[model samples]
Target: MKVLLGISSSIAVFKSIDILRGLLKEGVEVQCVMTKNSAHLISPLTLEIISGKRVIIDLFEKRERSDILHIEITKDADLLLVAPATANIIAKFANGIADDALSTIFLASRSPVLIAPAMHTQMYLHPVTQKNIEKLKSIGVEFIGPYEGELASGERGIGRMAEPEEIVEKAVRMIMKKTLKGKKFLVTAGPTYERIDPVRIITNPSSGKMGYALAEEILRRGGDVILISGPTHLQPPIGADIIMVESTEEMKNEVIKNLEKVDAVIMASAPADFKPKISLSQKAKKESIQYLELERTPDILEEIKERKGKKLVVGFSAETSDVVENAKKKMISKGMDVVVANDVSKKGIGFGSDLNEVIIIDREERILSTGIKRKKEIAKIILDFIEKKLSN
Candidate 1:
């Protein structure tokens, strides 16, 4: 397979050479492309010698073109991997602003684009950078880790590029999964409501950040997404099959109906445990007397898990106390192969916020991971873990 090894302006650009060497060792052809600043950190001569191809810096460089349109490497190659992708480049690609040679090729390419962003923790966590990363994934851009480790800023945080070996492995797996081409996924997201009146409803302010991130990741990993969402002010994740519902009962029935199909069911929605006995059409008037009946909602996640013959079932449990204990209970009760548990009491993290701290308690009650990170990054970890499990 032909690969476009694009390098962005980051100190970590030096790592791309190892990635190129590994790919070439696998007998894959590689053409190196570096941003103007990247060339200063890592010499173009080193890449040319390593890949056995002249590095392309200027888009219109006087290089001979074969019948293969080298300009549209995205169209000709099996994959395009951009290591040490910087925030500037990520934003340029997100808004379709192509101001440089690297950006131009990205715009012209139709091949799968994989980006590994590297920068300071502050820059990586900045709202603008976060939004750009979100937008890129919305358009089918894959990501490897900006892992938690040392950084050029003389501090340790989450802005390190993924190890070269891991990046290559993920790239290969992603390219191979295109064989499941045209395969689609049916995913549910957000917290559901059980209305008591037009104005007042029983719903969790779950934020729906994680589920939305998962839906976006599904699109990036090359699967069609049918996202059944509950009523939330949050915008529906783009590149998904959006079906909006207002009540737990509505979400429950939808899950049962869509269960027979799809490659996987990521039951990330926090459907209300008990809904109001009566759903009033009009807003309720304030009164001194207040009493209402409640009833259990359908167990959508468990029902689907039981009925799922060969499909994947993933569930989420957000606990305020006894995080591990409650998560384990839910994993068994819900019959979920994988359960994501997190404490939502911490400020600036989990529920209604952009970040989350989570632990993956498998069916065996084994803790998979625990830490605070952006929901998008966490979603990638969970999705990659599940993909590995499915492969085994």
Candidate 2:
């Protein structure tokens, strides 16, 4: 992917270096464009060395090619990003003033534009700046953040530039192939509780990292997500339609209710397998509790089997032994198109851990293994497989 990195004058200008590096780490080709005033804050040569492309400063600077520099630079760019966008640049962009190379590129570029603004809190909140921002947005420009935090002035407010990692993540999402566009997915995450009493319940160690990762990946690929999640301390991915449920029965009901609305169902949640035969209305006395009876919880996969029809169904199995074999069997029995099985018996992976190693089995008995890796990486691989299946 190719990106036009536009930098304007601001104390947050230092962050542009990290942003450029992050994009390069993602295998993105970056061409840096700097406003003249920005050069006073950070040297253009510094960016040039890191990006390996000569920085563009003056619009009238001599170039080996005779082509219009501003227009030519933007023609092949997949995206145009302005980080540490100062009030001057923002106003110039909104009013179509192209006195400098960066503003000129903004006026000439047809690609998706993302701006991260940085300025004094009062300057950002000022009606004039806000009007300019809105004007840009009305014409299809997108903004990341001027998040609330300590500003360059040491006064805390809402004009701090978003962190480098966040800016890069948003840029990647904007440039990635929208293969899942117009598609919707239903993803369940976390662990469901089975009531033992109003004060007690049975649950698992699931942190919902895997499920949340999958939801984010789906969203990044342009798929609409209905995230049915059990109790977890994790934040929901942005842009997901979230439904919070507590018990296995509630999770099952929500899944079934939203089933028909999605093209695929990913059963990533670990719902309780059993529940108390008779849940007490009040908290059970510790002394009186002895040999409590249990009953099987509703089998969500089984209940949805016949209703799934042509929609793709994916299930997860957490096993201690015969992981692949058990997953294959479960895939067949539950009418699932794919099954992801992992061994939770090992240390430092699965459950509450951010990492996982899994064997992916298909209904056809084909198997693929992902050696222990971050849940986010695994999420991408799963979605890549799903995208391939969808395309075929």
Tens-digit lDDT track of model 1 for 139-169: 8899988989999988899999998877876
Model 2, span 1-392: residue lDDT tens: 99999999999999999999999987899999999999999999999999999999998977788999988998899999999899999999999998889998998999999999999999999999999999999999999998999988899999999999889989989998988999999999999988888988889899999999999999989999999999999978878999999989999999999999999999999998999999899988888888779998899999889899889999999999988888888898998999999999999999999999988888767788899999988998888888877777
The TM-score obtained by model 2 is 0.86
Task: Report the Cα lDDT for candidate 1.
Answer: 0.81
* Candidate 2, position 60, lDDT: 91
Error of 2 at 63 (Å): 8.2
Q: Could you tell me how far off, in angstroms, the CA of residue 74 lies in candidate 1 after the best superposition?
A: 10
Error of 2 at 49 (Å): 7.1
lDDT of each: 0.81, 0.93
The most accurate candidate by TM-score is 2
Give the CA lDDT, 0 to 100, for residue 307 in model 2: 94
What is the lDDT for 208 in model 2? 90
The C-alpha stretches of model 1 lying farther than 4 A from their native spots are 1-183, 364-366
